[model samples]
Target chain A: ELKVEQNPLFLSMQEGKNYTIYCNYSTTSDRLYWYRQDPGKSLESLFVLLSNGAVKQEGRLMASLDTKARLSTLHITAAVHDLSATYFCAVVNNNDMRFGAGTRLTVKP
Target chain B: EAGVAQSPRYKIIEKRQSVAFWCNPISGHATLYWYQQILGQGPKLLIQFQNNGVVDDSQLPKDRFSAERLKGVDSTLKIQPAKLEDSAVYLCASSLDWGLTVGELFFGEGSRLTVL
Candidate 1:
């Protein structure tokens, strides 16, 4: 059984603050994905990290993968109210993808 | 090109009733997936299809659930004798290929099912 655990399941931060969400998996996998989902909406792909030390950034969000440690992180810099949502990290192995429980972020204005 | 498409944005039915959801993947996509997501949880893969063939249905409940991708295009998922626990969102996603290296999935808005 592949287990993916996320830290700080609930986060409350003010606008313009910086925070990081961590995802740790129990197995070895080379592919990791980050997604954002608003209340009542489906998931929106945020980043796909394909290799160890692979980092990708879009706007104020940055994601990095460390395959050796079986971990991934999504860093939010200078957050805004619009950035508030539930974030999830999924690790894939041979087409079997397991997702973390998720981190619910509340960005206050 | 349009994104993945799903029908019946929401549905409500009683226990023991049957319901079906539909999905149309992005054009030319060879891999399609169906996932069940309960509130506050990540999507769980129910079934996957590569063209007209089934790739993985290990997580699917065959006794009550059935899905098919005909003509290697649009697909449908059916649940007979639905149970209260079946109330959740059913999402449809599609990828260009099966290999993780070559594919990134695009998801539909999802069909929300409510069972009484």
Candidate 2:
């Protein structure tokens, strides 16, 4: 069974601070994805890292994948209040996809 | 383009009752997925369909849960004799074939279920 683990399940960071959420998987995967979900809302795609060393960034969020290590990361730079949400990293293996437990981020002023 | 659409944004029922949720995927999407997400947890895949055909349903609990996609367009998920643990958000997502992309999925707002 493929499993994904995320560190710092709950994070409270001050605005303008930088933090990184780690996602570790147990098996080989061709790609990984980062998604954000707000209270009572569906997931919003953040990034798709398809290859090792692949990094993608948008606004204050940057995601990178290391396929060999079976790890992925979502880094938040200079976080803002609106960045508060639950972030999840998922790895796709064959036709099945496994997701991490998710990290809930709260940006406080 | 419009994203995935789901009905009955919220539903409350007593335990052991039956409930159903509907989903309409994006236009021309070939793949549809149903996910169950408990509070403070990531979405777990329950079943997947490929153009009206069952593709994967290994994770689904066959005894009380059932789902089907008809005409390769719309899908419905049903749960009977629901348990308190089944009180969670039922999300529906759709995407193109896996070969087209790295399995990027578009999700609906999800139907929140509360069992009393």
lDDT digits (tens) for residues A1-109 of candidate 1? 7889998899999999999999999998858999999988888899999999999999999999989888899999999999999999998888888889899999999
B6-72 in candidate 1: lDDT tens per residue? 9889999999999999999999999999999988788999999999999999999999999999899
What is the TM-score of candidate 2? 0.97
Per-candidate TM-score against the hidden true structure: 0.98, 0.97
The DockQ leader among the candidates is 1
How many angstroms is residue B66 displaced in model 2 relative to the true structure, after the best TM-score fit?
Answer: 0.6
Model 2, residue B52: C-alpha shift (Å): 0.5
Show where candidate 1 strays beyond 4 Å: none
Q: State the displacement of the C-alpha of residue B39, model 1, in Å, after optimal TM-score superposition.
A: 0.7
Interface RMSD for every prediction, one decimal?
Answer: 1.1, 1.6
- Candidate 2 residue lDDT tens string, A1-84: 899999889999999999999999999987888999999899999998889999999999999998888889899999999999
State the C-alpha lDDT per candidate.
Answer: 0.93, 0.92
Note the clash tally of each candidate: 0, 0
The segments of candidate 2 whose C-alpha lies over 4 angstroms from its true place after superposition are B99-103
